[model samples]
Target: MSVAKKLASQTAVYGVSSIVGRVLTYLLVPIYTGAFAAAEYGVVTGLYAYVSFLNVVFTYGMETTYFRFANRLGTDRRELYDRVLSLLLVSTAGLTALLMLLARPLLGLLEIPPGHEQYAVWVALILGLDALTAIPFARLRLENKARKFATIKLVGIVANVALNLFFIVLCPAVASGKWLPALQPLVTHLYDPTVGVGYVFLSNLFASALTLLLLWRELLDFRFRLNLAVLRPLLGYAYPLMLMGLAGMVNETLDRILLPKWLPDNFYPGQSSLTAVGIYGACYKLSIFMSLVIQAFRYAAEPFFFAQSTEKNSPATFAMILKWFTLCCAIIFVGISLNVEDFGQLFLRRPEYLQGLVVVPILLLANLFLGVYYNLSVWFKLTDRTYYGTYIGAGGAVLTIVLNFLLIPLLGYLGCAIATLACYFTMAILCWRLGERHFPVPYPALRLGLWLLLASGLVGLGWWVQLDGWWARHAWHAGLTVAFLVALYVVERPRTAAPLVVR
Candidate 1:
């Protein structure tokens, strides 16, 4: 099959699980925001942000290392897999143990209340499990077992959502005598009236453990062999990748972690910083449509690009893929930006949390650039110029830090959103420029740029033509999205659609 067709097929399969899973997972946003106070939700968000950062440290760049080594000609695939898996198992276990031992000091460092320290422990466990499972999950991708991969991922997400609903929504009512008495005790203890945010992490830990069991086939395939020679080269390749991953993650998540500390004292007086963080985090979930698409694309794109590295016209093929990815992502950006008023209603059930709606568009645009950067980054990977990626990512991390430092105190969470967008946009552009020097792909730069400009215009028009009432506003915004898509299609019909017609 053509690379495009293969990517489409795999992405569709992956998307089924990703989109549905994220949609289901998104249901928990309402549950969380409604169940927890803003401060409580902020604690949940900050702790998870910390978890995301630690995950990068625990995995230590092994997932991509697997891809790099597994695809190389001279390597023993099974031994490489075993070594990487064993390394991950040891590292993650050690990290988790270390965290457990120092849990008190860590909680003290973060200044979380005694009651909420358990939340940190729950997050640490979940991240450890996720880190350990990363290789097995990557093995499924390497083997092209998209069906099994999608199934396991979907099931984990579904289990997470189910648990959240049972604990936060159903159990409370049942325990409060609003429902049947028969099931009350089953979850009465589980549904802690005061432990609102803790259950989110607890549910995630349960789901991660459940997912490990579901992936037992992949996990049990592990062996205990160590290849010293393989380890040297793999480490060399992955060491920079580790830096890239760390810098990249810090760029993506530092805001969530630092916003509370950085915010001005009077921004939301008398409330805990956790509340501000929670509002930002919950509202950010609205941008997950863009995130889900980008993530699924990355999963398919990385393997697909690696497999196609030796093909004729591979650079051109990659360029085409980037163009299509940008176009589709731009469409999504417009769709969401135009209809954000409706989408914001999904999680911002309270008036206090509605302030976070401003960050939605900023985050959505940042994710778009992040996706483009991922696509552009193939040049370094294909040409063994991975150091460029590290450099670009480091630059982005610096930008993220500087912007958050400057703006967070002045503008609060909005500064974080702006800084994130700026960081990603800079990273994407840098990657593209550096990739041109290393392995130039004939990206449809002019056309893709035009598409972005046109979409921006349409979004601007939607804002200009403000309609009254929810139904009217939704209809108008939907119409704007459709019109923008049709215009984009018309402009690119010859290049994108004519060949299909001729075929």
Candidate 2:
């Protein structure tokens, strides 16, 4: 099969689980918003933000390291795997244990309330589990075991969704004599009514534990060998990747972490900064569709791109792939932006969260830029010019931090959204500039820009037409989406069909 076809197949397979899993995860947003106060949800948000940062630390870019060494013609795959897996096990286990030992001090440093230290501990454990699982997941990609990878991922997501339903919905309803009267006491005891935001972390920890059990095959396949000779070069390649990953994480998540701190003392009268953070975090979930696409593409694209790097026309192929990727993502951006009001209602179960709906389009577009950046970034990775990535990512991280600091205090969550867009845009442009110098790919820059411009205009037109109510808004957005589709078809149909007609 052609490389493009292979990638498309892999992306579809990965997307089945990723897209479904994210949709399932979206169910929890409503549950949390309904069951907990916004401030309480903020605690969940802050803790998870910390987990994102810690995950980068614990994994230390070993997943990419595995990919790099595994692809080398002369490397001993088993030894490389063993060495990497052994390093991960030792590092993550030690980190988890150390955190457990210093839980109290760590909690204090994170500004966790005295009563919420256990939440911090649970988050640390979850992060540790996730870090350990990263290597196995990477191995799945390395070996082209997409079926097993998707199955394991889907199972975990299903298990998580089931557990969430049991705890948050079914358990409560059963306890209240709405579902199962006989199991009331058991349900009530198991489902703490006052736990509120803590259950979000607890559900995640339980899910992680279950996922670890499901990864038994990949975990046991490891053969512990510390090959220092292989390790030396792998570490050199991976160190900058680690820096890039850290900076990327900061760019992606620092707004969640810093927004609370950057909030003015009296911004919300009686409510705390954490409260504001929770609202932003919950609203951010609306953009997970963009994240889902980016993730699925990454899963398939990394190995595919690396494998194709030696092909004669790989650079041209990459440029074409990136152009297509941006066009697709821009279309999705318009679709989502046009219908965010209805989509926001899916997760914002309570009235208070409706305020955050304003930021959804901004966050969605930011993620779209992020996806485009990822597609453009293969140039650096394939050319072994990874230092450019580190440079661009570090620059973006600085912008993220500065923007959040300046804007979060003044504009609240909207500022964070704008900052995210600016950060990703800067990274994409910087990477493209550096990449053109190192390995010029003739990306259809003008055509891609025009597509985005057209989509933006369509969405803008849709926004201006006041579709009176929910159903009307839905109809209008659907029509607008169709309009975008028709426009794309009109522009590309001749090129797409000419070859087929000739054949």
Leading candidate by lDDT: 1
Runs in model 1 deviating more than 4 A are 189-191, 227-229, 269-271, 497-503
Global lDDT scores for all candidate models? 0.83, 0.82
Query: What are the TM-scores, per candidate, against the unseen true structure?
Result: 0.95, 0.94
lDDT of 2: 0.82
Tell me the deviation in Å of residue 137 in model 1: 1.1
Which model scores highest in TM-score? 1
Per-residue lDDT over 320-375 for candidate 1, one digit per residue giving the tens place of the 0 to 100 score: 78878888899899988887877777657777788778788778888998999999
Name the lDDT value of residue 421 in candidate 1: 93
Error of 1 at 115 (Å): 3.4
Q: Candidate 1: deviation at residue 142, Å?
A: 0.9
Candidate 2 stretches greater than 4 Å from native: 109-111, 464-476, 497-503
**Residues 1-503, candidate 2, lDDT per residue (tens digit)?**
97778888999999988999898988888988898888888877887787787888898878877887688789887777789988888888899987777777766654667876777678789888888888888988988999889988988888877887788788778977999899987876788866656676788888888888888998888888766785788778777888898899898888988887788987867768877888899889999988999999999999888888889989767876776677788788888889887777877888778888778777877887788888888877766667878898899999999998899888988899999989998888788777778888777776777777788788778877887887887888898899888987887777642212110
